[model samples]
Target: MADDIREMSFEQAIAELEQVVGQLDSGDVPLERSIDLYDRGAKLKAHCEVKLREAEEKVEQITLDAKGQPTGTRPAEGM
Candidate 1:
């Protein structure tokens, strides 16, 4: 489920969030709907944050070590 959510584009995430907000605002949905919306919203928020972090890391030219783990060093500075 998380992997599927992560595959969604930013636009898709925003669209889903809008739907969630609408459902929450309507106050007509059952408890299950509210819970589902809340869960989806949480996932969307996390996905957006991850994407933003990755973009920032890329712009900063961050690189990973041989094991594909971040070296914890900034770009243009030796690891």
Candidate 2:
């Protein structure tokens, strides 16, 4: 589970998180399983956040020329 979760792409993490939310929302999961799902959900949420922040930083670092076209990328700062 550790390797699999850590390796999941952003999309995969998000989709699994949504499914975990659905199961928890339905109130049909056993208490024990719900607790386990909640833990996984927390990890997934953190992973998603990290992925989003990395993407945001990349977007921020795009160097633009006078015409506002992307010239290239700059080094991301304050990472």
Candidate 3:
């Protein structure tokens, strides 16, 4: 299950997290099931955060030259 979450792309993780939230919001789930869903939701949230951070780092690597033109990408910070 841990590996599954780690392999998920940002879109997949966010979709699942939204589903979990909807389920929990409905108040139809049993206590034990709700606890399980919450745990998975937390993991999904963390994975999404990590993916966003990686994307931000990559976007920050764009190197520019004179005339405000993009030259190329440099190595991302904190790689």
Q: Write the per-residue lDDT of candidate 1 for residues 1-79, one digit (tens) a residue.
A: 5788878987787788888888888999899979988998888888877777666656545579999988775554332
- TM-score result, candidate 2: 0.75
Q: Kindly give the stretch of ten consecutive residues in candidate 3 with the minimal lDDT sum.
A: 55-64
Prediction 3 TM-score vs. true: 0.78
Q: In candidate 3, what are the lDDT values of residues 1-79, reduced to their tens digit?
A: 4899999999999999999999999999999999999999999999999999988776657788888789988777775
Predict model 3's lDDT versus the native. Answer: 0.92
Clashing pairs for predicted structure model 1, backbone only = none
Best by lDDT: 3
Q: Write the per-residue lDDT of candidate 2 for residues 1-79, one digit (tens) a residue.
A: 4677889999999999999999999999999999999999999999999898888777658799999999988877775
Better of 1 and 2 by TM-score: 2
Error of 1 at 26 (Å): 1.5
The candidate, 1 or 3, that scores higher on TM-score is: 3
Q: TM-score, each model?
A: 0.65, 0.75, 0.78
